[model samples]
Target: MDISPTLIGFIGFGILLVFLAFRMTIGYGMLALGFVGFLIVAGWNDALGLLQNVPFHTMFDYDMAILPLFVVMGFFCYYSGISEDLYYTVHRWIGQIRGGMAMATVGACAGFAAVSGSGMATAATMATVALPEMRKYGYADSLATGCIAAGGTIGSLIPPSIAMIIYCVITEQSVGTMFIAGFIPGIM
Candidate 1:
């Protein structure tokens, strides 16, 4: 049996929608679609041959290694008490004034954003590390939690962001220029 590339493309899109609807992990969804598309385009035998080699090459890839390292670093910051110190330091320095604790939370989050790339991960980590202390201080729930959530989002916008850096590298542009360009937009 033979398949038209157009038909195969449509099938791939349908599968992609189904996977997304089912909430499969994005990376695994992409991998599955890519594999299916490869089989349709180049035949099952060739696709299998490539897959056998590709997984090994991809896993051992040095460039991609940074992704796991960053994830580990963020997780470590949460579990190893580093995040706790950061929040407390900010809290002690600025938690007295009206809205000062919230401000300090934002500041500390911006500082931590320098190290973490993923906004959601940063927010989750901050909540774990900061929420309890903020609550214990009689801080209002809405203010404390909202500030932490907003602060975490800064990780996605701040310079040295993985997305911004990767975009600049892929476009053959300077990372410094990309950082500068994003700074104004981020703060706006």
Candidate 2:
């Protein structure tokens, strides 16, 4: 009555796909199925210990705490109208230069990236705030979208990013040092 670990893994993966197809949240589905597979392959005690301890260590660690804080900051920036203010200020400053609107979009995205900490969110926010303005100025489709896509990626490279925070936690590196390290690359 023993199941191989490989077989359990395949079953878990299959269930994960089925859950995803049914529109379940990917993280939750994978977590539940992973635990189920662990219980079947290892034993009830090991599975229970994993369920009890992994989340505690992963989330309760002080270094990992910054991850949720940065995520919240991103939402705060989005909701506080700061993203729009930044776009307008940068736009007015550079609107007259050749390709200035696109540059301004990049600048605004960088500014927002500091607070948002999420690339996709940063891009979506910048696109919403900057795209129409660029369109009004007769900017081309590819150029505007390109600026947005590029700018969005800066969130991960900048400080207080969820990705960076996760990396620091997983590698047991200093969160502050990692944040500082990301700044130079993010700017270029």
Candidate 3:
């Protein structure tokens, strides 16, 4: 009685789902199942070789470096309180203009986006920093929130962006070229 390759593949997939359902850590579960599948499909030597080399290739990639640096910068920005300063600075410069507070929200959001390079973080920071000022100025909630939301989304498309870094890595494109392509579109 021979088990077909498709049957083995389906069995492995089911086991992976069970591991996930049982709250096994995703990385470990995938690693375990992957080794088993590879061992079966190829051989023990090949499976072991794969396990040995994959992490080295994944870790040494230049694009992986960007994420950690940005993460560190994000923590620093959060603790050093730069986001607050950004909003206040924009507010002082634009507060007198009609709809200036909302404009400030967008401007500050874009500024913070440069530092955080994450849409969710930029939006969160802008909401915390700008919501009150916009409220105090009697700006409509929809307009104020909408501006921040739009501005925050630009973070992923702008330079020093995490998304673009990963994208360039996966696509084997030039990071500088990708950034240049995204920059003007992000700003506009």
Q: Best-fitting candidate, measured by lDDT?
A: 2
lDDT of 2 by residue, 71-133 (tens): 678788878999899998998999788888898999899889888788888998888889898
- Which candidate order results from sorting by lDDT in descending order? 2, 3, 1
RMSD of each: 4.0, 2.6, 3.7
List runs of model 3 lying over 4 Å from the truth: 1-16, 93-99, 135-149
List the candidate 1 regions with Cα displacement exceeding 4 Å: 1-11, 19-29, 165-188
The true-versus-predicted C-alpha distance at residue 102 of model 2, in Å, is: 0.4
* TM-score of model 2 (CA atoms): 0.85
Clashes of each: 0, 0, 0
Runs with alpha carbons beyond 4 Å of true place in candidate 2: 1-11
Error of 3 at 153 (Å): 2.0
Enumerate residue pairs that collide in model 1: none
Best by TM-score: 2
The model with the greater TM-score, 1 or 2, is 2
lDDT of 3: 0.85
Which consecutive 10 residues in model 3 have the weakest lDDT in total?
Answer: 70-79
TM-score of each: 0.72, 0.85, 0.76
Worst 10 residues of 2 by lDDT: 63-72
For residues 46-129, could you state the per-residue lDDT of candidate 3 as single tens digits?
999999998999899888877888867866886788989888999899978987887788888888888888888889878877
